[model samples]
Target chain A: MSIPVLTPNIAAALAADVYDTIEMPAGAEFTPATGVLKTFFDFSRQGGAIHGRSGGLLFRRDSGFAVIGKGKSLTPYANSIAIAFRGTQTGYDWLSNTNTRTVTIENQTQAHKGFYELFKSMRPAMEQQLNPLLRNNAHAIVHCAGHSLGGALAQLAAIWIKKFYGNKVALYTFGAPRVGLKNFALQAPGSVDATYRCIHGDDPVPLAPVWPYYHAPYNGQVVRLTADTGIRVSSHKMRKVPHCYQNSARGDWANLISRERLQRQVFLKREDHHKVTFSEYWMNQIWDALTTLLRQSGGASAFVFGLQGLGAGVHSFYDNLAIELEKSGMNQQHSVHLEGLLACMLAFAGKRVIRAIELTARFIRWVFRQVLSVLDRAVRQAIQQVK
Target chain B: MWHLQRSTLVCILVGLLALFTHNPAEAGMFGWFKRIDVQVSPEIKGAITLHDKPQADMVIKRGTFFEDSWSWDSTRTDADGHFYFAEKTVKAREVLHERQVAVRLLALDYPTKGDEDLFFRLSSSHNLKSRSSDLLTDGMHCELSAEYTMSYLKSLEYPNMDWHGFQSKCRFLHADKVIVSQAELDAAELEETWRGIHSLLAYITQNASEMDTDDFIRFHVRSSAESGLAMLHKIRELETDIDKLNTLPNFEKKFQHYLNKLNKEDQR
Candidate 1:
């Protein structure tokens, strides 16, 4: 007997069930609610395929429905709940292909008007979905789930929902990329405090540069899961299972268990989770360390130059350090001390050269000033004698 | 006295050691003094001539008979005391281009006062003769005062970017008193126009990203046109004002008109 292949429809149905289980309330309009939910679904679908998960779930509130799709238009139908499930293989291909190229052209002044027009077209669909749910002022919960691209999209959608609805929504993204620019992550609405990004360490998809250097929406208490199969590059290159599960018959079960644990943790700690600061919150640690190094090595001028060179590398190091600190729950002061030590090491070589130049110049100026004073006095005496 | 001598010898030895250690003036001879020379070169010769005119006696000193017959010209002295002419006949040319002439101070005299020095001093002036036909010009009557010569050189050295050069060029062509005043009044106007054109270019460069493709293209065309027009208008106004002057020779008027036409066509 031959083993059965999972049909795309069956795969999509299985993926959709992850969403169908969540009970949307009575009289709740599904279009706006689902639109908000779809962002997460899209991200999970995308992320799950990359991580080889059966599926992923996204949860957030209704206000941010408009920002879900990459396109300028939203799907029609008021109160209709739409669940889109794309296959993991396509999602995996898109993430892993790495052949994308971007070209930039000069912008014209008049095109600003056209950009505003595109934004205006999306307003109607968004309003149609939002007006009904928000009219009663009922608390709306939108859940979106998918496997690969869906995961990434889910994070982006959650961001928009948080932005539009404020505290009315919560977001949960599994194996999702870091979303938005640094400022967006910082300013995301407080309603999104329930947002969680769960990453299985060996999963490569979640490590995407969505919001790498800045604080992520999820900061603490990420559930760790172990999987049986190592990541399969091709059918022939399979080795013993890596620490985290790759896609396998047993791996699917493991993924679901880990997800359930994460969901329980999120629900249990939901109230206190808001207190967790992002790992990158210790920017001041790096800043202070660099300043102290500068003062000790050469003074203000050396400090200024050193600060400039610290640039993006320092930012990246700070961000990575913050993550490590958060994972370990280590003392922040110790981490800061460690950061200072690291900065001192990196800046040591350059500081020596700057110090040498400064000392030489100072000594030369001192000697020159003294000689000039003596020369002035001697010239005055000679003139007086001649007179 | 013997002890003083010994101390002086010790001090000299120490000074020599210090000097050898520093070696401040590593470069040998010609290190202490910088040499400079001023010379005058002309595109043409006989560019300037003295104007001599007989004058009636105006006043007598007390009881002495006096007649003032001193005359002056548009001629200017170069650094080496050489005066060159621009045209063979000054009466035929409406304007003459003021050839740049370098002038150097032979000596400066200072009269000492009680803890102060008098600002006024006399300096010798010289003129160089030009041999070329293109350098010859009709003589103008003028007295070369040392103070006036100093003032001329100072004005050239620090010529105002807009007003001074424009006014001088206008004066050279028109020689009309009314146009001279107009030149002074409108000098800043030309400068303002140029500044506006430059400002437009700078704004485009800085904010190019904010502009869309069509807008970016339109802005480029508009800026180009505006700058060309500004330059054209400035030259045209200058030439027209010069044509109105009565003192300018005919040849200068024709030359300025030709240049004005060329600029107009070029702008188009």
Candidate 2:
């Protein structure tokens, strides 16, 4: 029942295959086996159907997926598999609730726990689906990735997976809150090797009820990513994009992935890559496949529409044009039709009374300028005549 | 002519339909904005409070929810660490209907602490009401007052033996100060007291490390000027630490120089 380790080649092959099949419109790239792997789950305009909820909560669940890989393997085949979950955004209501049962709170805390429960309950079903591809394979590594609420669920799922499989599971989460008591981390087997929790700078979620993680004996890595967004906007001008994801994808996640990659390069030894085995590699692929299916079926689609509308609404003209151009490249006929329709509408509008008014205003200003110049010349000529 | 007119009417109707379909809520011509002022400073001596205002404001559409409001204006503190809010008139008439609105300030110094000789007072214009009081405490809105004494003896920097001895002495002193016969500070209250003392001591230690010897002396002198008898005694005790610096050969010259300069200024 021990988790299997994955070699670099096997991990890379699985990652490459998953990326090929997964359709993420945001152009988010995945770099795997380099200590960190990033796959964007675009769940923008799926009508918030991914989590069976909409509105603020839709943003909470929109951008999340799981990561699966092997722990420190003796031979990549013998190493344990690990999984970690990300937490919710800093100040959002759904993430603030930590109690198990229906407590005095705003959003449902149990929804994420419920999602983890569903994932765990369906592990056998997932194993059944995955076994044919990975039966002879080594142990499986699993991780859940999320920014805000997803981070929390990733942590919860890792714990549940460990409890179910016993000593084979580990959790690596980012910006996750304390889901349970201080003992929760202790209860985790291979917790030291398997769990890593990273937090970006001044992310309010990690600081809220900050004592638990501060006092806990959890041996997970905590990374502080940059908090300052270079672009400044008044809080009033800020409109809440449908999901809690930032309108511009220029925040903690981007900083985190970059930092995590750098840290891996600096700290991880090259020998670690050679330790992975074929079975461990195949198991990682199965885990990667599960992540892909989960993200593709709901996550990525939601993000695409979410990002599209956000770009459109924010008057981020460049982003909107870029998105449209990208779409055009993907499907030429549809893009051409859209462009033609837009052009026709603009032409008609220009010919109307509103456009005429603007044209008249411009003409008046031009005529006034010309008349003033003529008057100045006449005055000079009059002076010459008098002389 | 009749056919042209009919076509024109049809086009107008279609355009109107499109406009309605595209955006249901028309954008407003005028925007409403609000201003908020928050002030937080240490109640300690020489912590100057200036009247030079710093304006902080949040803007919103007239009918939008208060929670959805945005910060339109934020001002930095002045030379004396004081902020002001200039009188701002929101242009939108729709937002003015609400009365008795709650303003939440992210004050840095929400809680203040002091020693037995000195007291700390926190006052706010917002008239915060305590959850514990109902009828008897009418004007006594959420005003938190705490008195305490701090010493570096209990800090981790001190030896364990010294810390134990110092803490025991503090406990005994704390017990002796109970004015009411039956009243005793609970474990929770004592723990809180320890935290406050620890925090103040930590702050002093940090400041002491960064400041020059002359600046340190000046700080103690200022404290002495503002303090009552009990605080003056505490200041004298702190001055002794400054005096002990004279024992270190490297520190002695600088210490003597600072003292002589202060004495010359006093004579003048």
lDDT (10s digit) by residue, model 2, range A33-109: 11112111211112111121212433422222333333221121222232322222122333322212111111112
Task: Kindly provide the TM-score obtained by chain B of candidate 1 when compared with the true chain B.
Answer: 0.22
DockQ of each: 0.00, 0.01
- Give the Å shift of residue A12 in candidate 1: 11
Off by over 4 Å in 2: A1-92, A97-140, A166-170, A189-192, A209-221, A225-387, B1-268
Q: What's candidate 1's i-RMS value?
A: 38.5
Q: Chain A TM-score per model, please list them.
A: 0.35, 0.35
Which digits, one per residue and each the tens of the lDDT, describe model 1 over residues B1-268?
A: 9999999999998886665334211111122132222112222221111122122221101110001011122333454333333321111111011111211111112112223111111111111122211121122222222122111111121132111111010012212311124444455344433343343344334544433444333333333334434444444554445543332343234334434544564587
Residue-by-residue lDDT tens digits, candidate 2, B1-268: 9999999999999987676334211111112222332222111111112122321221111111122231333344345443333322232222111111111212233233231111112211111121211111111111113222221112122111111000001112222222111222133223222232233233333444333454433443322222222222333333334553343343323334444555666687
Alpha carbon lDDT of each predicted model: 0.27, 0.28
Interface RMSD of each: 38.5, 31.8
- Report the poorest 10 consecutive residues by lDDT, candidate 2 chain A: A230-239
